[model samples]
Target: MPASTSIARARTDAADRLVAADEPLLGLQLRCGGDLPGVIAIPALREAVGKARMLGLKLARPIIAQDGGDSVTAWVEIDPRDDGCLIEFRHWRAKPLPAEDEGHVARRKLAAERQIAELHARLDARQNVLYAAAETAELAELAARMDAGRGRPWTDFVTIPGSAHQQPLHWRLLDGAPVAVAGSDRPWRATLVPVGLPGAEPAGFELYLGSDFPAPQQAEPSPVAEQIRARMIGREVAPVLRQPIARIIANAETIRSRLAGPLSEEYSGYAADIATAGQHLLALIDDLTDLEVVEADDFTTAPDRIDLAEVARQAAGILGVKSRERGIRIDAPKEGEALPAVAEFRRVLQVLLNLVGNALGYAPEGSQIWIRLEQDGPMARVIVADQGPGLDPAQHDKVFEKFERLGRSGDGGSGLGLYISRRLARAMGGNLTVESAPGQGARFILTVPAADPAGH
Candidate 1:
């Protein structure tokens, strides 16, 4: 090799070696912090500082705080040949200390290296045997939501319209069941149950009214409409035995309250409501769990339904927690007027989520997003208006287009959410339309007719 080429190769090789060296340090730190990527620098720094501290050596670079104490930054100087970052726990502490063991300095340095090596080996071993728990946390949250539903059909979550090639075919749970799924050709054998099996069963959670999958080739519905409908319900075997669930809560409350007379009949009735509500929520969840699965399918469309007003209320209730989290208000009519729509509840909810989520995200931290339902003789209209920056008339259609960024890409976007949503509404018996000019806020209108049944 020529001199210049050799020098270039040497630089590349040296950089690769530096990156390799950093991996082990970062891995060890991640292990100690229970897989937290943030605290990685801490353990890595201990190794970086070990030799210097043991030999009465000092760092050429000073330690510094970053992000106003949110994180700590430090530099390591080692022959300029090694290029890497160092991590030390001394971030919280203002300064570093050199030890006073001059006589035993060499031995201490050896001991430190041995200790760090052993520790790193142990952490590596654990990492190898175990798994990244973040995935588990996600499942746990899903399970919690499922449990909240209490034996209702669990719909998979989908947000974007796609071939689902981007996602895994299915997700296996720690317990070995395929609890979640996506991008699959085969129908799952087991009805994936969320972890909190018995926990979210508060009351009378019943299964779906029936297993009547819609006809797939019904023009508007997909050619795979029946399959999608089957996919929608998934497997919600049965509701928690409501009487029993209510008994459990009532008994617990009775035990805690020390209320006499074997608890009033009304107390049990109230207990039943919690379980009933839980079951209703789960039924709603079964409707919702499909949010992600459907979103991921490019060909996915909406099923026809009526009662768009009820869906709006249902959506408002579902989003109630999210809105309240950011001090935002999601308004529903105190006395709602019936606005029938031939549409899929889930698809409609998707629009609600987008408009609501967008409103919450773009509007001032504390603002209200309203879902208003209005009815005229043959037509019913549902409006979702956000107090955020209204879209310009030019951008109205563009905003509904897929992958169209409205300055909210950082909000964990597939960007196709709105496009799929609008498509879903149109696929059913309605069209999702937006009305707003630049300076004013935006309003999304979902209009469907009254002739359709309660599919909405």
Candidate 2:
């Protein structure tokens, strides 16, 4: 090369950070007018540095590289030095590669591959499809194996929208299945079974398909609360079960208390146990349904202008009977007191009920539980203070996690109440937090946006 010929250079320490660059590299921005940092901006240069460090020898190669949209051909050399790897570049000139058309085609193919890979990754993560194997079958026969159909292509079993016709073909390439929505608005989860010898490509395939939703006409009813709620809780499952459970509890109560005809002590004790078990089962169902609702991706709260103090009092009232039974007194906000907050009325009540219920469960007998409300700038708050043994600092984070009960089992708690409550509070643009020391009583704080006078 001539003495006056130009070259670009850069250097990086063993940590792969840019430390030095020549004038040519200082002005190189890859694609724009901005200057490049004096660091190792190119992966190829970094690889060369790493290689030089590993071999402890000088290395040189001529390669085609890109600076933004411009392609540059240059000779690069990396030498291991005490400070780090020193890189030298010579004749970094823009040059178009031969067979440009072939390069474009290769790039397009890689992009398509990346798109398909991403789709497969998503489907795999969701457990949307499973792989199976069989000896010989057509698509329709495969469908029959899955109980989809007996003698037709798997495609015929699903009613794919016009834009989704290629979805099934794509699934075949990925060795998986595709989920298609049926005309009834329910989803059909489909899986493909490969028909071939072990470790061999599928000679044929079978299709397995099923509805994603539960069948309403089934002989046994779904015990899930969310599934029941989806069809209107009161109109479907709750009315049927709650009424009977209530009657059973009422009758059990009458027998246990001897309010009806006189009963033997043994039968009365049995009735008491039955009622207790019934109550526990009912509470479990409630917690499970709440769990389902809060965990749903589309779960949301209906925000409204409401009074935090009012909600706190309502929660206290609802738990009053239980509080009295335990000889625990509830101190709620004074009548007509208002703490304006922006949140959903029902959701706020739900969160407060969970918190207070927890407090009532743990608070010392005859101790007072205070439900207080206040307004801070831009925020409204409700503080539930209990005389229960406070939580350790270490347990604060763990308590809000799902299925966490701080080692307390058989307490009729599913460990999901706090988790679900916190989620609901957040959905209403608020948060539920706790403050306590091991010796100090626990204080739970619920905060939400302050309601403005304009009803915003």
Candidate 3:
């Protein structure tokens, strides 16, 4: 057989061992952790060759493989012979992997950790609790204890294994340690990540609590009833689907940002589009899940005394970077301002986030958004106002209706946010209302019962 500079050839035995190969193919085989006369190591090509040989057929396809820090792509034609398979490679190309930004990697890791964490806490430099949140009912008591003991070391509320020192151990020593929490039987692991300059004394810490196993589920129900409950999209399907969709978004982002490797501008733009679409799908899934919950007859909120001003500030902080990216400013309530109200803390935060996030999306670049707090006769109120295209009186009422976008499209909104938000407000004995005229901007106001002055 004659060899051409444009095409590379290789041969495999009946047992799928790479018996021979040309320059780049041979070099790639070894670079991908394969031996000279050993089995194929490139997963996609190996599978294609295996199928071609087994079926005694010829196959052509494009395959991609990673070689060291570069990505290799090629079109390969596999022909099955009597005793082996012949491999021909065409248009082989390799591109060096891109350099990833350290800050981006750190941010991605932090986001992943937060996604899996059941409980989260912010700690001061001395490890005193600044704030805490628990996602599960089982951890409610622990969160409450931490909230009540705000200035105390977080370790005081849980039992750490192997050490009985009176003082909390250094963050490095406590990170990834196992712990036991009160009012819960499941074993848990703790993660403590320091904040501030790389080599300087830490400014604060972020604490995360996770468990290898889920909390025990309720006793088994009748088969028919179980089947019906399992069909609930929110309770049964959403959790299973969220992880894979999130991965799709993350991978698309890596490609769009060229963090994995260098890509042509056209391909990079395609990746950007993919990431945007994935985000839209993820948002729709979330809205559907919330819709199911808020529409259920048994839905209710765990009302508690909460600070509306603090919630407003937290929502603003969460969206601050996004606002800055769009050249918009968020004027949140001052640190000293406090508006106590009786509502579910998490629900209020969710509603406020939706309002602020919507404002950021529609508000003109370089404009300002305001989160203001006020107290009526017996209700505590918070208003999110933005300088965007305002709604007319007719559209104001329709905005909160289910799946109502008011003739808008391509904005990546599901139109379920306001509806779900209104439902949640009503569940908490609160009301969400909008005040706006067609070109004067818009204000979304939420009001809930005020906390009793007597501490009732």
Q: Lowest summed-lDDT stretch of 10 residues in model 1?
A: 118-127
Candidate 2 local lDDT, 1-456, one digit each (tens): 112246677776767556777765555433223323444545455566778888899999865544433455568888888778877888667643232345333333322222112111111111222222111111222322323222233454445543455334644443334455332344544444343333644434434443324323334433332233453333355334533554455556655554454333445578778766766666665676677667778888767677787677667765765787799999988767888888876688789989999999889899999998878889899999998889999988889999898888777788989998899888888899999888678999999999996775
Number of clashing pairs per prediction, in order: 28, 7, 0
Model 3: pairs clashing at backbone N, Cα or C within 3 Å:
none
Cα miss at 432, model 2 (Å)?
0.7
Model 2 per-residue lDDT at 90: 82
The Cα error of candidate 1 at residue 442, in Å, is: 0.7
Model 1 misplacement above 4 A = 1-306, 335-338, 407-409, 451-456
**Candidates sorted by lDDT, best first:** 3, 2, 1
| TM-score of candidate 3 to 2 decimals | 0.69
Using TM-score as the yardstick, the better of models 1 and 2 is 2
Estimate, for each residue in 185-256, the C-alpha lDDT of model 3 and write its tens digit: 899989887754347676567799877666564455445434334434644576456556656666777776
Question: Which one wins on TM-score?
Answer: 3
Alpha-carbon shift of residue 184 in model 1 (angstroms): 16
Models 1 onward score TM values of 0.43, 0.48, 0.69
Cα shift from native, residue 402, model 1 (Å): 2.8
